[model samples]
Target: MGIEIIHRPLRTKNALWLPDRNLIVVKERMRSVHTRCSIAHELGHVHYGHVDDRPKHEVQADRFAAENLIDFAEIRDHLGWIGHPQLLAAELGVTHRLLRTYINVHRLAS
Candidate 1:
């Protein structure tokens, strides 16, 4: 699908996807990494054909974004050992919260 990305002010969420319209609306003021992850997550929703707004779907989308955006093997190779979550997230160009979620979802020790 040719999804069009639109950057604008969103009241509640950082980004949302309209599957019917093939559009993704993102908050313009969001940080670049957040924006990228948000878009990736939304794209996951689209790719997975998720129409229900359920917690499981959201988790799946988040996992998809984390898996695709942050390569675990690459990060591990580069960092060797991750002592701090913030440092690892910063090195991976992702939010600490997202990194934690990724770790939890993948059952990886941080």
Candidate 2:
């Protein structure tokens, strides 16, 4: 992909893709798992050739990141023990939003 990744202080955004430079910029001060997910999300945007950050494009990227970060088998294994979403997301080392996206995809697959 030849995409370069860099960390910066983005006050409002976790990560974003620069199509012109083929670069992915991630927030510098986030947690480790969050940083990884953000990078993955930006990579998703690059993979889909999204030139702009629109809602539809965001959803696509989120789905891509979630699918890549979360394993369905692990989700299933954790479902019985993890009753709260926050805990589940924590256990999975992902954000709640990513966990939700993973759940939506999981439902469709099932």
Candidate 3:
């Protein structure tokens, strides 16, 4: 799949996936972690064959990003000593919100 990645200034959305053109557009000013997550999420959309812009598709994409980006075993092994969410996020190289979402969606006991 010849997927092209383009970075530009997006107004409302962090990223968008054009399935027809196999294109992923990301916001240029986003932080590195955010850009990575957004691209992963868009790739998730592509992998899962999500063409409709629905909430379920977004959730699935989120799940895909979380599962692929963070290692569950690593988090489980390190989470006990990690007191702050920010610290855990930093350790996992993900945003605090993405970490929280992964915890919630996976129902991992914290």
Please give the range of 10 consecutive residues that has the lowest summed lDDT in model 1: 74-83
Cα lDDT, model 1, residue 93: 88
**Considering every candidate listed, which one attains the maximal TM-score?**
2
User: What TM-score, to 2 decimals, does candidate 3 have?
Assistant: 0.89
Query: For residues 4-108, could you state the per-residue lDDT of candidate 1 as single tens digits?
Result: 999999999888888778899999898998998899889889889987658999888888888888887866675554667787888888877678778887677
Top-lDDT candidate index: 2
Alpha carbon lDDT at 71, candidate 1:
88
Query: Which stretch of 10 consecutive residues in model 3 shows the poorest summed lDDT?
Result: 76-85
**Best first by lDDT, ranked:** 2, 3, 1
Instruction: List runs of model 1 lying over 4 Å from the truth.
Output: 78-81
| Candidate 1: residue 35 Cα off by (Å) | 0.5
Query: Which model is ahead, 1 or 3, in terms of lDDT?
Result: 3
Each model's lDDT comes to 0.83, 0.88, 0.86
- TM-score of predicted model 2? 0.92
User: For model 3, what is the alpha-carbon lDDT of residue 68?
Assistant: 90
Residue range 12-102, candidate 2, lDDT tens digits: 8999899999899899989998998999899899989999999999999999999899988888888764558888888888988898898
For model 3, the superposed segments whose C-alpha errors exceed 4 Å read 81-83
Deviation in Å, model 1, residue 100 alpha carbon: 1.6
